[model samples]
Target: MEVMKVLHMNGGRGVTGMGDSSYANYSLVQQKVITMTKPITENAITQLYYSTLPKNLVIADLGCSSGPNTLFVVSELIKVVDQLRRKSGHDQSPEYQVFLNDLPGNDFNTIFKSLPSFQKKMRNQLGAGAGPCFFTGVPGSFYGRLFPSKTLHFVHSSYSLQWLSKVPEMVESNKGNIYMAQTSPPSVLRAYHAQFQADFSMFLECRAEELVLGGRMVLTFLGRRSEDPSSKECCYIWELLAIVLNEMVSKGLIEEEKMDFFNIPHYTPSPSEVKSEVQKE
Candidate 1:
């Protein structure tokens, strides 16, 4: 038995991705959100770390993908748990409750399909669940309660919080100015700040509600070089993508009306900005 469990919970991760293009659109959206955490290494010495590191803990992963990527992370987390257990000096195996979570629209069926193989590998290596590993699939918005009160000891979310519910129509409309000049004009940057402020506040409130007191949360979100909340380069990726979309529209690849429809529900919060939000928790 694996006493402890590990998780990469991506709460409310798939909210921004919507519409008739549910398949490809979701992938693109997830990619954009995950890009923020590409450099993440999962430091073992964060403030949220355990003092003795419990050998038995319930772990949940939110916004987990539905393919090889998801399984790979699960394996890595399990490895972490294994390391923690070995130090405990107890030969007794721990019972693991691994929670794989995501949006209701996430490909849960596909994730389940790969579970048998994961279990097989774990059983061969450690000897736990039905065969050797205990695995569980939990589908829901991590933004709210994903588990019972104080049920989880450790939680992790990677490259998933940058997502906002959805970009407001008024902000994305053609009627609004969308230029970000490094010089005199600051409206674009100010608007961007306002947008981030709105979503970031929500993100903080939601996470605070889900996590129990003393429960640690590990998260990696898209960040920016500018300490200022109003940096023009903060969202240059989306701007570039918009330009590309316009090019496609000129070639009749997509409708011009959809230029406003193109949106990635992500916001790169600065360290200070994130710190301020965390203070509210």
Candidate 2:
């Protein structure tokens, strides 16, 4: 499948708010991930504020998928900045320009609809001390440029970036598998790693041009603990998915040819692999 063209969260809320596949209903783990990484995120924001102290603070949340979590990041940032400004005896709170970004296919309307309530909550929480917060959505893949040069002060992405821009080329021979698997040949592992290196490098390079001096970025995504691409820690979930898919194929629910052509455009790189790419960029 062409991931960029076809892939998106099942947009909108679930019917009856129950057993449906909408991202809004199914993003608890993502929310927890955000909560888990809050310390790192807060520290980055704190450092950025201390270093630059821009009166007009600009923040971008790349892959800001629609749901309750959509504005959670913005709220957290506002709180951090507000406390900092108060402690520093700055009478004026920094005006905030928040850019919530995601793929074009994301259900941004849901996020838009929630803005009134979000603003109301902010008002109640911060009262008269809050600065104006303006939000706009930018739709595009972050693997390429999404903002103007030196326009962003802080960049954040959570539970995203594991998705590659596209499925790696030269994996057509990875039959009976939807991702790198223990049974796959060494070439398949190399292909996935190579794709991550290229994609992540481009992501860093683009962000470098967009961020202001001393800007901060915090990215949280799925990754492997082990160096092996096919290790169970990283590939086990995909392996289980492949099993279900093969079962469907056996029952004639999906065409074998289609299954053969399908491979998920996702990779969970190890820390060393990520460090290598960062150094290269």
Candidate 3:
């Protein structure tokens, strides 16, 4: 864990054109956010689910980008496993099978290269006496199942699920707009909202398929608590981006009318929405 923290001092897997995922590094900004609330969330996960992990636990982190933050989360699972084992009074601890998953376009190269060092750090921190822990990458969309049935004992993901598979197909120029552009003359917030719903629902279904019965998953994602359906809080981003694009048009730096309508392919589902989906799973 000491070594893991050391590695983290370095940042996030950068966003990819293919939407590449990189390893988490600690930017001053990122470290501040990490310190703000993750400890409480981690504690909750540990208290409730630590004892339930089976021996030889097959744990997987969905959307595990190659970054320092990923290490932090992975290390939590490792520590949790250790604590559980100590309580169970077993010298033979579960082997950790970590599956670092993300979109296919993810930088498998970075993950593969850095993973060796991560393993070495783990070995050094854990000691030769500690039970074996294995690391592997599963590259694919979290919107689909990337692992075998009932294989995962515990699952985790943070910050990635909010990303949709692609810009909504509806969002294109000269082609019928499947997505509402932030630049659309009147508005396309409704279209954006629809896409978020579709993507998030798909995410829930995919995860439900992969996790074991009674297994637990801890997820932290971008969201809001506002109850109004048409609140501007959600769409204000489009307004802001529109201001910038409008400037581009005024400067003649870009086409005045051709600004592809754009908005984040995201939505913060109500807590009730999340809980209801969990129940279905």
Candidate 4:
């Protein structure tokens, strides 16, 4: 039977366990974080100089999931801004107001619990005369407005935007697959691509409204180097997972019907897709 398993992945047990299984402590994910450091530093340096320096800076880190990784970008910003302010011979450090945003169901308390250490580290890095740094939690989906118009100076997000806001309609024809797999029908592939396009466009539109005229945003998420959405980088892992799940179905460990309709609401777009969305925005 071709039917949709209307599962809302959000506000589920996944939200609660996220902080525990966080990418912050994972080695592979940490490597990506390291790889991003140079570009982020350069971007901050460029943006800091690209405009007249503001005395009070407003910064937001979108998709700021709970864990050490959540503070990774924020700490980097504090360092860059502090060093630049000192180098420019400014007697006073810029006061920073940082907003950490994520879904309302996210474990923000974990982030809240870790703040003392984060602030202490910031103080230790910036010295005893560090500027006032305040961090606030803004819980909501980034596909819509989270902050006021033209208020943010800098925004950064890492390894988050692969999630679609919702699954596309008419995916029942693409049965027996949990995501974009090698055997996924052309119709299934088209539906997934269409969803990504819609969600990503709205993401850009919302961010454009929130950013200042010259504000900068740095985002790095899952994406394929090739134009093909079903390329190995995008679909291989899900393909393997599907194989395992189907194996379970064969062994009678999982219901065959459940296997037929389950689909993951995640999409890894190609570089061209991202550039197109940015240009459209």
- Considering every candidate listed, which one attains the maximal lDDT? 2
Candidate 3 minimal-lDDT segment of 10 residues = 1-10
Tens-digit lDDT string for candidate 1 (112-229): 7667767777767654421135567776655455676556655666666665544533333432122332331354455555666766676556656655556665576667778764
Error of 2 at 180 (Å): 0.4
Best first by lDDT, ranked: 2, 4, 3, 1
lDDT of the candidates, in the order given: 0.55, 0.89, 0.59, 0.75
Q: lDDT for model 3, on a 0 to 1 scale?
A: 0.59
> Across residues 1-281, which tens digit of lDDT does each residue of candidate 3 receive?
12111222122343321222323432335445545656765675465455564666677887665545656667766776676667767677667778887655555565666666777877777664456778787766777668887787777777666555555444335222222333443334444455566667787777677777766676777565765333455556655666777687778886755664443455555577566666665
Model 4: lDDT of residue 10: 25
List candidate 4 stretches off by more than 4 Å. Answer: 1-24, 27-31
lDDT, candidate 1, at 122: 71
**Predicted model with the maximum TM-score:** 2
| Alpha-carbon RMSD to native, per candidate | 8.4, 1.8, 7.4, 4.2
Candidate 4 lDDT over residue span 10-75, tens digit each: 221232224334543343564466465757656764676438588778889887766556777777
User: Clashing pairs in model 2?
Assistant: none
lDDT for model 1, on a 0 to 1 scale?
0.55
Q: What is the TM-score of each candidate against the true structure?
A: 0.69, 0.96, 0.75, 0.87
